[model samples]
Target chain A: MLEKGRISNIQMEFIMVPTIIATGVLSIPSIAGRFARHDMWMTPIIGSVIGFITVFIVWKLHQLYPKMTPIQYSEKILGKVGGKLFSFVIVFFYIHNTGIVIRQYSDFITGNVLKQTPAIIFSITILFVSALAVRGGIEVIARSAVICTTIFMITSLALLLLIKDLELGYMLPLLENGWLPVLKGSFIHNAWFSEFFLLAFIFPFVHHSAKKGLKSGMKTCLYVMLILFYVHFFVLTMLGVSSVNQFYPVYSVVRAIRVFGFFENFEVIITASWVLGNFVKVSVFLYVASLGLAQLFNLSDYRLIVFPLSLLLFLFSFWDIPNVVVLVDYMTKIQPFYFVSVQTVLPLFLLLIALARKKRSDHV
Target chain B: MIGEWSIILLVQVLIWMIVLFEWKNLKKASKANKITFASILILSMILSFAKLEYLPGPITLLHYIFGPWGWFME
Candidate 1:
């Protein structure tokens, strides 16, 4: 069981920021560009607005039951049966999601950094390491995030060394398609932005004195969003909108960075930072799945399930997708709603019900 | 994508073994709890396999019900 004294608000902020930023930073610019074209930078701002509304909804629910997770409050709002069913849905979703995320990071590493290496090796290695962290529980994961976030920030600053190659003309003719495309792209990005809903699971577990945890969380999310926008803007300005068509523009940008000839090939550093971020992201999801499973069974311990669940996740990561294209298609087309609903909508619904029930109980 | 079928099968068996090891505690679970757990497991299994096929028939049905909410990227 995770003890209540384990993590503080600052630690929680560290955990949430890197996990949300890591994978999205790599792929979002290109994905958003697919819809928004030259206007990709605006999508994050619009997405942030939508994201904050969703966060407000989640925060309102937390205010209703300041010390209960969605799982605990669901049972309070709905009866045991309904709540368990809802929790089961959420847990299963996390399991599937965790597998896909693990696969994504593995595929990315193998595709860019270790082209000759079999992706399954990377997949299993990452899952193995993450499973160990999950077993150590959320406190270890948060501390790991703090260290990884510092490293990530340092690597992000390294991109500044490439400013000489940047071309401001790439971001010109702003909103060539008008604001409509930007708004449409925001909806796609909104799904990505709503990932902060994971905070709902960890909120009740934070040490109570961690003042303004939600505010810190939202601020961290906005900071990450700002960083993402700036990174994408820098990549666009450096590589141009046409060059951004490549699958991993950020990696390409890193490869393009050449300082004094001796400082070239910075993709290695970006990949290393990304690997750490992916570790935190995967471990958080895996921990959530394990915790949800433990609660579903009313078990006293979640550690027993960690290794077994990770083994299953490793298998599921390679289950049937034969290539990267299929994986990308599934991620962009089919899976966004799965990511959004269980993580965002269902929690909001549970929060509303919990709030109403709290009011009713207080009236009595 | 390169894992041997045997490895995949072995991992699945290991998961079942762990679940079975925990089954004694599950015995005390209410009927509703059992139903929910079973449904979740079954649904996740179905979706996992559906990804193997090109279309993922059940997910398509879900997408259809959700009704063309910007997934097409047009």
Candidate 2:
């Protein structure tokens, strides 16, 4: 088989940044606000536990099997049937997860931007673009993410303009609901932080010679949590408890920007960058799903399945998500456990199995 | 209703065009790949035309299975 591709630690780090941050910056602030209220900013400290554990686990798994994805290496640790079953389940999970990601993107865009353009179009079009990017493979996606992250960061300058609205007093009532709700708020981002498992699919492709990948990956996860923490802080300080009523709090914050009564509607600028970041996010998940499918089926070329997988994704997303009300409900109530089970606990289980087996292939 | 059907027809045409353009390479796909490809393509086409009535949402599925276990998924 031809070498799939390789990406430097920096590119991997860049990819991780948007993949982790894109969802939280859009969806989490409001959800976190609902639970933690003024203490929402404090949730990231607990969120960091998820980030550290996930990245650390994936990194250890990668160290154990240097040249193989979890899909490929599971067969080595467990015998054929068990490994194949594990890979099959996780591959399907990745595919299903990608569908939900696209659904979120479709919901956000259709609800906020297009308004009337039926979500089918956005879902299909974005999935098509992501499929095209995935066809170019990981190097292309990583490089594209680098460019998008640069734009994404620049657009976040809108956050700076929001500083005038900051009120420290808004956070004065912190812990008004006690520490319990703050911990509950952490559960939302905890799932997001464990999404580092998505990177395990690409970990073998990472240029980790200098051990820079682990540091960079951890930093990337830290960056996402910190950014989410800051965004939550920013939103809380500006909108206070009112932010919890918003579907997209960061966008609401950006929409609130009015410098000297001249600069307004800066949200569009942030949306464009955010939408671009989402493209990378969806493409990465799409790539993982397609690549996993191809590998699972023993196909010669992953690209052959990208189109079909993407089409199926659109169909599944449209049929499955129905509306944002249900979507958000699922995210808060159900997705955290679902994600943690597949992304964190399952991988940890595999690691423990490999350890008990005492495989000679492992390296620290 | 005609407009919606026409939209579906146009999208199907566009999908086929891309498939045709990529067919030179896709022709090398194995029987399993071809069958899987064809099945997914047909599924999407059928879904495009379906009225979306009575389709259970993803959460509904999760809720149904997990609800009995006290996992309502809200």
Calculate model 1's interface RMSD in Å: 5.7
Candidate whose DockQ is highest: 2
RMSD of each: 4.0, 2.8
Tell me candidate 2's TM-score on chain B: 0.65
Worst 10 residues of 1 chain A by lDDT: A329-338
- Which regions of candidate 1 fall more than 4 Å away from where they truly are? A1-5, A209-211, B2-67, B70-72
- Candidate 1 structure quality by residue, lDDT tens digits, A1-364: 4434368888888888777777787777777777787778788888777567666766777777677667777787789899889988878777777777777787788878999997767887888788889878888898898998878878888888888887777777898989887876666677667888778778777776235766876787788778878877777787777654677888888888888888777888878887888888988999888888877777566666676677657656665556677666555665556667766778777777777777788999
Instruction: Give the lDDT of residue A92 in candidate 2.
Output: 79
Shift of residue B56 alpha carbon in model 1, Å? 4.5
Which lDDT tens digits does candidate 2 get at residues A201-303?
8788887623776788788888887788778888888888889998997777888899899978887788888889998899988888888877777777788
Pairs that collide in candidate 1 are none
The local distance difference test score of model 1 is: 0.73
Cα deviation of A234 in candidate 1 (Å)? Answer: 1.5
> Once superposed on the true structure, which residue ranges of model 2 sit more than 4 Å away at CA?
A359-364, B1-11, B49-54, B65-74
Q: Compare the candidates by lDDT and give the number of the best one.
A: 2
